[model samples]
Target: MPTSNEAVKLQHDAGAAPTAAEAVRAIDGIAPTTGTARQVADGVWWIRLPVAAGPGHVNVYALQDRDGIVLVDTGTNAPQTLQALTEALCILEPNHGTIRRVVVTHHHPDHIGLAGWFAERGAEIVATRGTLAVAHRMLHDKTLSRTPEEIDFAVLAGMKDLELAAFIRRPKRRYADGVAMLPNATSVIADGETLQIGKRCWTAIVGNGHAVDHLTLCSNDGLAITGDQILPGMSTNLNVPADQPDLDPISAWRDTCRRIGEHIDERSVCLPGHHTPFTGIAIRSRQMAASQEAVVSRLLEHLQRPRTAIDCLAAIYRRTLSLAERAFLFPEAVGYMNHLANRGEIVGLRRGKTMVWQKQRRPRGDTIRREASPAISRPYNFSSEVDESR
Candidate 1:
């Protein structure tokens, strides 16, 4: 895609109507249709898989390697998604090489679902320790019952007894169901660690908020396999965990966006988890931060009177939510409320079992201070297998 930098250069080069490619690149970037592969960068291909759930599609990257191809962020293990992925891989097989390493961006099923499938085909699984820990746990556990902590959180989010029960009784989509096989071993990568894939050396950068220890790798030339961290035209979900009610994901997300933005410039073409490949990393980072600030402002207005996270949902989203949607989005509402509470823009009080948030009045000339990023140590030792397992 032509970045803001490229557009500037284009103006000085010639004065003519833009080509179809240039025009699309100048606009909203390029979105590769599902079941297809497009070369976003030299030796780097963007493969999009069709998803029946959220976003309608998920993007995976295939980086050319010395021995084979290094696949980043596998799509879901659903039959159609797998078929689409297989077809895309086959189309690139003649030039790109075989699968050498499957690098998972996070533990989300849509992103990591096909890791086991690739691993079975002699591809080494690679991901952050935190991601591996959660992936392994979910892949091994088959139960669908809600935990005591989850029930408590449902109540805190204003979920009624009947509603909570119905949510629990609904059919579950387990993590194991998304993977073709169990991930027996993984090569863990740390933040700032450099990995050699083909002629490129990518530095692993950790991103939070969307997922615990989300892995993002930026090459020396500025091409980034960003996963879900820095998507174009959409805000990454910042969900608060039930166990960690006080965790401030917004601060972490904002810091992560800034941190990732520092590595790339306006010319870097980032391969994201969803949507399309685009440039202007720093600009996109600022946009994401601004988007969150706008959400916070709207939320503060919604808190004119005391309101529960559930009560403010309509005001914040302005849409009717299904039971499934509520189950998926309730934690994010808590996250926004917690972010406001942490900023001192709002105060939360316990009303029996539920928590109601009220806007806080600050003195004249007083400014709200930004919260420091949460310090959560990653589970580095979660992997019993070593990197040499490959």
Candidate 2:
């Protein structure tokens, strides 16, 4: 018989995968309806809309201005998503002409896909320098592109090619940095700067990790447009792309989360880019911190078994992932693993063309105990078992 502590540990150690119902429940709860807007504070509204064949919807925020509305984050470039946003805006302001500016929290397609459409209608677009560059790269640079062949290589390198292709093809148009060339636009907003939109003022705080130069807009009305920085349901993916192989997203993301937590008050309502508005900034910040910490813990556990980064990724993701998903998974797993390796909790060594990780001998027994147990080895099968059973 196991002690209560041991039982709890076993339960935790079991690594029970989330059922499809649980996943759907988690996602469905965050996004109650497509294109529905929820008022979180005075003159502030959160909106969710479906994107192209993705896990969940993308969230955008609208701040009512005395003259017009300041929109933060446009949905994906799909016609339906655009139509949903248009309808929601019409409901909020009645007169769509009142939308003064469109500020993108980041350059991700889900956040900026419809920015050009809004810009065509006279909303100013803004983002960080790095974000703007990446957005341009995403749109214009097709030469150095990661084609299906590259995806297949990634698959052989340990990823699912089909999913990777789906992820890559989602973005429609990418915008260049700075204010878009819209006739009725104002200017590009940058870090440590403030902009007055509608009846409120917002400050742009730029940080990196999830995306290069991700911006979180904080308003005096106790509202923060967190974009994908802090999601309510799932952890945000942090990766080091083969194109930008030198990027260290884990450190950047950790620092960004800490900064956001420090600046915003605990009671502030977060208008994320993918979920309903929620309160308790401090609590969410702690949760975000813990989530990343959990990833590090998972990485360390895999290291004890002397697995390569590819092996660790399979262990962490635990299913046949789409090529796109595998692309997202591998770099994220390696990044967190590298972060822990840098902290001396684990060690990574290059064996031929692969990087294998292992635990470092630490002084404290508690430190060893703090590291999570190894993952249960399993084959990759991305299909939802719960969905099949149902």
Best by TM-score: 1
Q: On residues 1-390, what C-alpha lDDT tens digit does candidate 2 reach at each position?
A: 001122222222233233312222221243435556666667777787776633446778777777778888887777788788877876877753477777787777778777777778766677677766766666665454456554543443343346545655655222332223322333566777888876667888887777877899887777778887776545566665555443456566666766676567856777777655667655554455554555456666666777756667645654555444444457666666655554557766655544566888666533332222121111112123211321
Quote the positional error of residue 155 for candidate 2 in Å: 9.8
**Model number with the top lDDT:** 1
Model 1 Cα lDDT, one tens digit per residue, 1-390: 101122222222231112323321322356666667888777888888876666677888888999889999888888999999988888888776889899989988889888898888888999999898878887887877777787788788788777788876876667687766646677999988989988899999986777889999999998888887876656677788888876677767766766676688768877778777777665565555555555666787889899888777766555666676677778878988877776667888988888888888888436464453355332121112211111
- TM, every model: 0.85, 0.74
Model 2 residue 46 CA deviation in Å: 2.2
| Backbone collisions counted per model | 1, 12
Candidate 2 segments whose C-alpha is farther than 4 A from its true place: 1-36, 95-97, 143-186, 318-324, 365-390
Where does the lowest 10-residue lDDT sum fall in candidate 1? 381-390
**Looking at candidate 1, what is the lDDT of residue 8?**
22
